[model samples]
Target: MTSSSPLHILVIEDNPDLAANVCDFLEAKGHAVDVAGDGLTGLHLAVTQNYDAIVLDIVLPGMDGLTLCRKFREEAMRTTPVLMLTARDALDDRVAGLECGADDYVLKPFALRELEARLKALVRRASSAVTPSVLRVGDLEYDPALIRVRRGTRTITLPPIPLKLLETLMRAAPRVVRREELERAVWGDAPPDSDALRAHLHVVRAAIDGAGEPPLIHTLRGVGYRMMAPDAL
Candidate 1:
């Protein structure tokens, strides 16, 4: 995407020719683009640094784009818009990518200008959505509007996805939200294939139930998770 001030972007694609073409076009448009030949390097760069947007490829060594994108949301807590690249025109791959947290995608052999347009739309959507001011369950609090969480006096910093998950749980405090329902809220129509939810929940719980705090996020065995003060449970 072209901006008045240049935007920094990451492109994680293994194809040398394709990567070079994408980078060259974006650089010509005044955006700084960082290339990662594989998923591992891409994940590292994305986790450690901040980028305005990411252009990710679905297939790569070390890790796939689907997992990398999911980790970006679940672990890094990054809300940076992602534009996924794929060679397949199959609907399943696109859905899988979106479910894994990609903001958008373009099939391979596409126009550079079209990719750029989708990337611009992704950035705009990330910036424009309005979220509620506050959601609380007892001492636990999550502010989607500001993108912050708090329990008692402790402030919990979570990546965007976990934070959203926390908000969903807290808003339904003391009630066991069904697995299907929570998944829909977290990943929209497409959820992860593996048991990825629990991993993200672990990070959320670590931050939310640290030290003497009674765990408010409770797994309801076969059901789902519920948020409530221990006394309330």
Candidate 2:
């Protein structure tokens, strides 16, 4: 799989063998996987961490998948796509999963290939709808086509480099955009210098996070940068 094709996934399954097989298959596909053996732990990770998609089991310890999915959607206010796994083939069971916000469902003993394909579809759907004509995160708004950037009622102006960086960050808002990814988006393989991203990001921070406005651009030090409203933090 290409670097861009790899998705970070969360696997919430109590069955050790099934979990291992699923994890191995997904990892072999160049995806990152995180495993949670119980519902409570799964819910914790689901809320606190970020994942491209989730594979959840219906029957779980501590909390059932239905309750977990409901809490994730209602309480946590997350829109991450969830593909539920269950041994039950009943129509009501499947409906329950969907009613609780699961995007897709798979009966247990499913093919690993099928599982991955479903996840890919879910991620594709989410990514497709992620960006709108006017991208807004908190009070920050960016219109890529119009080349307009604003923080609340205040209009902001930035240099070309910083504007490009801002667009990249806003497009991946609330998700950490790695330093390498930022460099590629703006300057491709030929970034002027090692410190070029840092310098440009500094400018972006200053342009959008002026006084009276809540800071939106955050540096992750060794990791990367993420632009999110304070509530998301």
Candidate 3:
């Protein structure tokens, strides 16, 4: 991502004037902004859609900001950077907001420029978390930011699960990745039973292997799987 790249932002504020001002200012900065007037609407959008950053208000009708933020983090498993809007004197609310998972908070009477700067900082942090510097093994390469795979010069697109599987494999390149380890990396604590890991690995292997170059993924008989150049074996 570049400094000029437009970010998709979700602004959940009840005040019309504040919402308009924020949306307009962020829009002027070349960001695509989505506005929700209530916490319910905001929570729905935040959970269902993908946004680069979120500007959330502390109080809203239907649900409070803290509850919404908590649900967004816990239920959705999302780490989208959140910039909270709060009154300066609401010290308790600010503390509670951070506890509920707001990345940073901006005072109600904050300077618009300062708010934008903090948001950009949060975006930089979040981007770094999701997009590794680079992952390479042999002649294969993957850019997590772009979510694209390449061998030599040919680029390929993959579905979300296979893409994640490929990332796990490439990150552990030339080493055997245990089945349980890959499952936990891809599916977390709630992995599917009954050889689901094997099924997904099959798809991932077919996508990254077979056609381009030699097969890089290999089964290790009774143990697990490893990725390596053909000659490495």
lDDT of 1: 0.78
lDDT of 1 by residue, 1-233 (tens): 33355778899999999999999999999889999999999999998989989999999999999999999988887888888888876656665776677765676788898777666655654665647768888788777777777788887766445666787888887788988887787665756534446655666676788667777888878888888887786
Q: Give one digit per residue, the lDDT tens place, for model 3 in 72-190.
A: 88788787888888874444555566657776666678778777776776676455446556888777889987656888877864544456678888888878999888877755564
Off by over 4 Å in 2: 1-4, 130-233
Global lDDT scores for all candidate models: 0.78, 0.81, 0.77
What TM-score number comes out for model 3?
0.55
- CA lDDT of 191 in candidate 3? 56
> Candidate 1: which stretches are off by over 4 Å?
1-3, 129-233
lDDT of 2 by residue, 47-68 (tens): 9999989999999999999999
All candidates: CA RMSD in angstroms?
A: 7.9, 16.0, 14.1
TM-score for candidate 1, please give it.
Answer: 0.57
Position 126, candidate 1: lDDT: 62
Which residue pairs in candidate 3 collide? none
Top lDDT prediction, candidate number: 2
